[model samples]
Target: MNNNNISIQDRSKLFAVRAIKAYTELNKRHFDDAGKVLAKQFLRASTSIGANLAEGEFAQSKADFISKYSIALKEASETRYWIDIMIRSEIISENKFSSMIDEINIIIRILISTIKKLKDK
Candidate 1:
């Protein structure tokens, strides 16, 4: 789909997919037991971002939509924190986590803008 046509849901879904891939890669790297724990936490937070966005799409009211979007934004922030931990703990490389961080930031921006528009309506 064209960039203009792609919805926030689509982008969030893509972000979740990327997160899963990263999780798999982390396992392959043979991260210590602690790394495994962090990986699971990261996976949950990352995937939740998209799940919340999708749920918001069917919200019964504008207020519900805004609430869901806000949750998704919070989840996105949590995902970023996990990425940073992974890099600092040496479970993942700086270069790898940097790209993931960039993608998460894009999702964060979209979620913020979407929430603002909904509130203004």
Candidate 2:
């Protein structure tokens, strides 16, 4: 498939966008010192999704693409981890945390399936 044919609204891209937005909003809120550490980790992991996706797009081969996407998948998982920590620590409310986690979970599944399909080809 041609890269230009891919829409920015694709699940992977959309999830990354949502993650970045959520992290930016979270960063604006004041937090205790301990909470701040989780916040920073959350921001980094969330933003890494898109950054890695961009790298995947420019991959020189199928293996390179899969490698970059695998990194994105890992980042999504990491984002989920930090989100869980934030919710359990009361840094973010259950409702907000759950929504973000749901999105990340969906993205993870999509990435996994895509990787599998590519590997099979």
- Indicate which candidate wins on TM-score: 1
Model 2 CA deviation exceeding 4 Å by range: 1-10
Q: List model 2 lDDT by residue over 28-92, tens digit each.
A: 88878888889889888887887888888889999999999889889889998998888898898
Positional deviation of 2 in candidate 2, in angstroms?
Answer: 24
**Could you tell me every candidate's TM-score relative to the true structure?**
0.90, 0.83
**Root-mean-square deviation of Cα positions for candidate 2 versus the true structure, in angstroms:** 4.4
Candidate 1 runs further than 4 Å off: 1-5
Clashing pairs in 1: none
Instruction: After the best TM-score superposition of candidate 2, give how far the Cα of residue 48 lies from its true spot, in angstroms.
Output: 0.7
Q: How many Å off is the CA of 36 in candidate 1?
A: 1.0
Q: Tell me the whole-model lDDT of each prediction, alpha carbons only.
A: 0.87, 0.79
Local error of candidate 1 at residue 73 (angstroms)? 0.5
lDDT digits (tens) for residues 1-121 of candidate 1: 2255677888888878888998887778776789899999999999999999889889999898899999999999999998888889878888867777877888888888988988898
RMSD, every candidate, angstroms = 2.0, 4.4
